[model samples]
Target: MSRERFVVHLPVLATDLAAAKRFFFCDRLLDGRRRCPLPADHVGECGPSRHR
Candidate 1:
């Protein structure tokens, strides 16, 4: 039998797996195929997580 496989674009190290699992980021889809760059539990309007 064949098993389905999946690929992870961003891979975390085994040692950091625990921390990585706890990390959260906003995944709201935006126009032009962009995603929100804020924390997953952010409040107010969704916007960039940084300012330059």
Candidate 2:
């Protein structure tokens, strides 16, 4: 196997990296899925701006 260099930006993703990771990772949570778009430890505080 060989490694190739490829650059790709997370288009309009959450400003919060941790949240974005969770979202993109598709982590399951209560009621459906975990809160995201923000690095929130809670379930309702979906803060941060993706465009930011």
Candidate 3:
């Protein structure tokens, strides 16, 4: 087995690696095998983004 095979990829920002390291998704399990599409640190509800 190659060492590369053990590497795991994660979502990260290029400009702010420090912040990206701490970033997290809502990942809340929703109905019908769906997940809450929001950031873990989102201010509003834990659903789709509201259009202004």
Q: lDDT per prediction?
A: 0.68, 0.48, 0.63
Q: Which candidate gets the maximum lDDT versus the true structure?
A: 1
Candidate 3 vs. true structure, TM-score: 0.43
**Estimated TM-score for each candidate:** 0.48, 0.21, 0.43
- Regarding lDDT, does 1 or 2 come out ahead? 1
Q: What's the lDDT for residue 14 in model 1?
A: 50
Which residue pairs clash in candidate 1? none
lDDT of 1 by residue, 1-52 (tens): 9767674677655557556644656879877657887777677777767653
Better of 1 and 2 by TM-score: 1
Clashing pairs in 2: none
Error of 1 at 45 (Å): 1.4
Worst 10 residues of 1 by lDDT: 13-22
Show the colliding residue pairs in model 3.
none
Top-TM-score structure, candidate number:
1
lDDT for 35 (candidate 1): 80
> Residue by residue across 1-52, what tens digits does model 2's lDDT show?
9667675656766778876655562223434333344434544535443552
